[model samples]
Target: MKNLKIDREKVLLGVAGPVLALVVAFLLTALVLIVSGYNPFEPFELMFGAIGEQDVQVLIINQTGVYYLAALAVAIGFRMNLFNIGVDGQYRLAAMLSAVVGAHFSPPGFLHIVLIVVTAMLVGSFWAGIAGVLKVTRGVNEVVSTIMLNYIATSLIAWLTLKDQFGYQAEGSNDLTTGEISKSGWFPGIHVSDLAGDIYGFIFVAAGVGVVYWYVLTRTRFGFDLRASGASESAAAASGVDSKRMVLTAMLASGAVAGLAGMPVLLGQTHTYSQSFPTGVGFTGITIALLGRNSPVGIAFAALLMAFIEKSASQLSYATPPYPPEIADIMKGLIVLSVVISYELVRRYGLKRQQSRVGRELAAQAAKNRKEVSA
Candidate 1:
């Protein structure tokens, strides 16, 4: 019971870290405002109003899917301590390939659309597998390899977009992109109240990810082995778990999910891929993973929180005083830094508490045994 109480206290402490960080960050911002001779309270007041505005809310909603998908990519790899910096390359290449497939195939209906989406996942997984295979076979450091691969993937996609063989050619056009996909291949939007439907659908998808990923990590034998391998390769190997195989599988799975981040942009918004695809999403995944502490549910909230800040930053700038847009980036950095440090602190504290509780319990048991023997 004492142990349980300590565990509960640790959990509360973990939860409090983020809240504490927020307060600290706000106070720091207030200090900055004072130094700058600006009214700190005024900006915050305007921020509150901007958040309540409809257009700003919609913008935030739209960003939910993008952040959720990107974060999932980094979180999966983080679970294994694999730094998948090539998420950008994998996601972009898969988006281009999937876009081409979607455009060329001209699927007739829903089933065909499903097939195309699945194909995208395969392409994404395959792309990521390249890095995983390199790591497993040659002992290549994923950080260096993934970063190098990002350049290669970017060049390859750029070349493909301009080449005639890949069907990216236009008769007399400078833009290097394939034609738009058929309407049937699109992910249909949903209607939630008076607002746009894409956000609602995205929220549902994010929730699904949380549920499925949680199950995959906790309930399955594969998850157990993956976690074991992540914790220690030597220990896992001694236990007969193939660390290499798990690494490869986890990387592939992570990339597949990252690829899905483009689904909203490809199937819903743009209905096609282009050379000027959104790039920072994969990198942002790293920050999201840190903020989320590698938990799927935590990632969802982190993503949403990030999306809200980004959305509001833009709208608030337009509505009130034109503060520097880079403020959003600064805040994101601070949040991620705070969360990572807080998570580590909480984890360490929890472990210490458990150890102390066990020691006390054993000591008490020993004393009781001694008394009984004397009697």
Candidate 2:
């Protein structure tokens, strides 16, 4: 009973931390808005009202798609203790490469779209392989190297959009975008209504990805080695784990996932790569990774929650003041902060309780032994 109570408390604490963080952050943001002469209530009403049937359909497809792919990408390296901060670069480069390939070989109908996506995955994986090689051979820290690589990729893509044969500029204009992908290259949105088409296919993809990620991370031998390497390099090495090889492989895998993330924005949403291809997706991965605690399943839920808040905020913007709608990012940050702090606190608390329990058990055993001997 006592053990069960302790376990229950731990579980409750885990759940409560994020919830409390969200509530407190919103209230605080609301207070700030009130002082700014805006009625928080009005905006709140508008935001919810904006979630009309049509908007709900779009919101689910766009925001949810981004969240799942981005979070999973981040979690891959997180599992291996390699901070692959180059998700932005990986995603951008892959997306552009995919677009370029699709343009090069105009296939028939859906085949064209499929080729572009596959090309994106290959390119993204290869790009990430650069960081892996550097880390394994030159001992370059992936965090630093990947950050620099992001800048290089951004510049390279920027250049590609302006150059001949690779120019993705608008006709007679210097707009930084590639030619629109073929109509057949686009992933058709699932039909929710005659007036509204929802991109339900992406949601289905996300669900599949979540399952695959969970299986790979928890059920596979490769997953065990990755976890072991993340937990301790020396211990893992001693156990015959090739830490370096794992790092490189994990990084490539992470980049591939990030590349897939761009598909939503590319094939599903925009059907082309633009100068604005890379948003804060890579950075957002950090938030999702932390919120999800690097668990594939947890990441899915956390990503959904974030997507929900973000979508809701956008929806509310139609009726409410900007305050309520703008509060999504703030809420996300607070939730992440709370989760981090709470995780650390709970971990320490658990360790102390474990020590106490062990000590008590040992003492009880000693007492019993002494009595038996005396008797």
For model 1, residues 47-82, the per-residue Cα lDDT tens digits are 667777776676677677778887888888877779
Clashing pairs in 2: 43-320, 43-321, 46-319, 46-320, 47-316, 168-177, 168-178
Looking at model 1, the pairs that clash are 190-197
What's model 1's overall lDDT?
Answer: 0.77
TM-score of 1: 0.89
lDDT of each: 0.77, 0.77
lDDT, candidate 2, 1-375, per-residue tens: 988988897777666655555566667667766787877566556555656668565765577777788788888998898888898888888888888776668888778877987888888788788999999999999899989989998888878877675766666875666677877887776766665556646566767887888888899999999999999999999999999999999988988888888887777667667776657787777787777778766677777777767767765556422455456776667777766776777677777987998899999999999999999
Candidate 1 weakest ten by summed lDDT: 193-202
- Output candidate 2 Cα RMSD: 2.9
